[model samples]
Target: MSRHLRLALVQAPAESFEQFADGLRLRMKSPNRAELVVYPELHLCSRGAEAMTLEEYYDTYAEPLDGPRGAALGALARELGVWLIPGTVLERAEDGKVHNTAVVYGPDGELVAHYRKIFTWRPYEPLCVGREFVVFDLPGTARIGLSVCYDAWYPEVTRHLAWMGAELVVNLVQTSTSGRAQEIPVNTANAIVNQIWVASVNGASPTAQGRSLLVDPEGHVQVAAVGTEDTTLLAVVDLDRVAAARKHGTGGDSWPWDHFAPDDTPLELPLYGGRIDPVTWRPAVSPWTPEALRPAVPAPVPTAPCPAAGAAGEETAR
Candidate 1:
């Protein structure tokens, strides 16, 4: 398979859906000549105290997997002749909750994948969170593993995606003013460990600390924005490069636990009856163990503070 590809990262300050769409449409006017265009997370909503309530935000900005925003994005991808990876948005779900969703469109304006941020940001606790990891196949290119902000902090998730055969990973982040710095390394490490390319974008200026970065399989920043200014960054990635790294003696050359070890070894645990059921979100126990050994109760969902900032007022500006 061919590895050569180009990517564009949109780093702009946004206050509303129209503003975000305007920036993206302008960027589409003269695309970066890349195979993919990535935008920052939550680029559709205003940031800060004025950020809209979950309901208000969804009512105004949320799109179905095939809504206008989705169609427009798909059109941009087809018009530019490149894959489009817009940052995450608040997608209205039937459960009356908003999902931190990311949508990917193929070059032909086809829906490739739609993923919700599994590890939702703590501050945005009131917002609904996704419960599963999702990956989708690219028609002519390699499969893509998708995740949203905060998911990068946990490598196990990325590792799982990699194990599932995702050659490329897209992380859509809307990092607050204070969290960008710490998030970079976590994301970088994730790319390195998975031996896959990671394209990440963030909000810039008054909206966010836009430091969109495109990382190579070696965990090096191939392209990035140096300042907190609103701008776009571009890079060319050769998929062959990532494949070669994996073929070589790289960190995540393959699954970490390739061969089964002795039962006492850490990697052997899974082989020796320590595996989690992939279908059911539960641990798989040994057949010899009696049912009495099971835990009496399921783990509790931890409660956190949600400022309830938006539900009570009009979307506040930062």
Candidate 2:
């Protein structure tokens, strides 16, 4: 059984919700429809709202995960018989603050997963931040991870997703600034380091600078650069390649995952005030486990510098 997945990344710019729905309908009507269709960030927030205050705009359109927009988006996916990610929505959380949330609707039109933007664009984006990382299994296919625009800037987010067994990470972007240039390399670098496919879909034209890309696990550009036009980047990602890359190595040579040796002491990350044990650092069922990873055995830790060369009996004392 070939673990190949056909996906479409829609780099459409900010448009009215109705326009987006119509375009998606046309997409399904076409013979080239993909199994999964992903749109850019804030693709349906309605661009005209820029005239309003941020608070008023969000309050006006923001909704819960199961709000009307969610229902409509889910129905569209089910009607089209395709997995859909309609990009990030303004989520009116229970805490009275709105959050930029990315959602996934399965072919059945049921909400599969949703992640709030943990690294919201900061001072510019005045919304509540999400506190969790999310990864979802795509049934018989590979595990897929989700991230918003600015989240890709933080490698920790994607790293955590890969650690959780994600073979692909999709970052829905809506960057209209020159910063998009810097993000190009960042996307590829993330793929190279994590050894996972990355689909960074950005909005196009008047709303954003476009330039979406689909990078493979080996950091190979599958669907390279596309201009600031309404584009649908398509590709067939092979999960087998992901397994092979980790088992063998990226480019069949570099295996950074082998950096740790079994029986090695936990490494301290002063940055996060955390330590990771070599043997159990990765999540359960990970390739980094002791038996599966089969890393090189390390030297035993010397106990307190040999007790200052004390007597033989004393040396063995606790």
Candidate 3:
């Protein structure tokens, strides 16, 4: 199935949820026969949480997965006969917990897949992070993985998704000036590792410069937007390229396999012994290091209760 699908990426100013949606609707008047339309992270809410208080923002802007914002996007997708990846939204789940969620709408105005942000930004730890990585099969030989803003920084997450047979990884990023450089490496590394396409949608303002891009499976920048102005990016991607890249060794002369392997033992060292600051006696550098660079190992997985407790009551009853 060697067919091409057109994907549109919107890079607009960080406006209020309602205004942003209205602007998008106006801009997307008649898409150029595109198969999908993608948006940037927190497309509804501004980043930094500077404009509004948490309580006020949540009450005023938060939507359920099937709420008005979602419904409208879904309807748009159906109207256009396309897939719509409406970045991540601050939404209230049935559990009453707030999550940063990405919802996919199919051409029929039905909810295709709903994925929440797995890696919550440091400032918003109070919000519950999503535990699962979602990859869904599309109608016409397309497989996609969805990610939120900060999630792109974690290469392991993208690597695993690539391993799970994702042909494309879509990221909705809220790129601040400080962390903009990191985005390229993160997305490109995934393409290099998994040999899949990456589509990134970024915000356009100086505070949030849009560096929207589409990278090939071989980590080549197929198309990228300028950071100067607000714009929408449109591109046609061939799924066959992803499959070919996976087989052709990413067109690289060399690959660093030694880097991805698990270490034999945890690296730890004493803090101090003979240091320059003798009175304080604190080591300038400690040998202690994490199993991986992204984060320390998570706590051990919990085990289920043993079956003996269930049988113990049966014997007494008999």
Candidate 4:
């Protein structure tokens, strides 16, 4: 039995929330209906260039997950009757720190999962790092993992998700004009190495190269946009293919995880777990605190005193 998921990658540039909504409606209304639709990273703030200062930009664009914009997106998802990964946005959490957050809405208009980008393309872009890699079941489809932009660069991000039973990885990207050259290959490699499907969507602006892509488990480019143009690319992802690919191995002698010895390995990295306060959205205990499972460092061996020097001299002489 072939389990197929029809997905659409939206590559349109929006200058305002209205424009974004319109673009989404246009894609949704397409004759070919998609079961899932993905948008680019920072789609809500694509007009930030018009702001005078960084603070001004964030202030004008950043919104809470349940804010008016988020509500509108949820409503749209319900209206279209499609699972929507509406790309990333500047999420102003209750902690007062802004995060590059990707949100997923199910067809019933509920926020299913929220993933913060662990790797903030730093020095180049100033953004707070996210602490969690979120994965969720897609009901009738495969398990899904969420990443944004630079997160795809780290092989561990996808591997961790795959290890946790994710069959498809969606990366929402906002790359600089010169970045597409690098972004495409890295994401392609991620899909191949992890033996999972990858759907990457980038903003269709001059600043962003716009080349959204969908790579199969075998690292084949199933759908890709040509240039910076307002367009949507559609493709059918087969979970059956993912299973078949994993069975064949990742084009290597052994699975990547097989290379590591499991003995004495910590069950979980303390850095990766936290308890967030539901109301405040802040961590009850910081993830940065050292974990108890960390292996203790062995003390340095005691050295012989003057005898060592004498012994060395005797050895040399002999």
Who wins the TM-score comparison? 2
TM-score per candidate, in order?
Answer: 0.75, 0.88, 0.74, 0.78
Q: Model 1 residue 282 lDDT? A: 25
Quantify all predictions' global Cα lDDT against the true fold.
0.68, 0.83, 0.71, 0.76
Whole-model alpha-carbon lDDT for candidate 1: 0.68
Best-to-worst ranking by lDDT:
2, 4, 3, 1
Residue ranges of candidate 4 with Cα displaced over 4 Å: 250-318
Candidate that scores best on lDDT? 2
- Worst window of 10 by summed lDDT in candidate 2: 283-292
* TM-score of predicted structure 3: 0.74
Error of 2 at 146 (Å): 0.6
Per-residue lDDT for 235 in model 2?
A: 85
RMSD values, in order shown: 16.2, 5.6, 16.3, 10.0
- Cα deviation at 9, candidate 1, in Å, is 1.2
For residue 141, model 2's alpha carbon misses the true position, in angstroms, by 0.5
Model 2 stretches astray by more than 4 angstroms? 283-318
Candidate 4 differs from the real structure by a C-alpha RMSD in angstroms, to one decimal, of 10.0
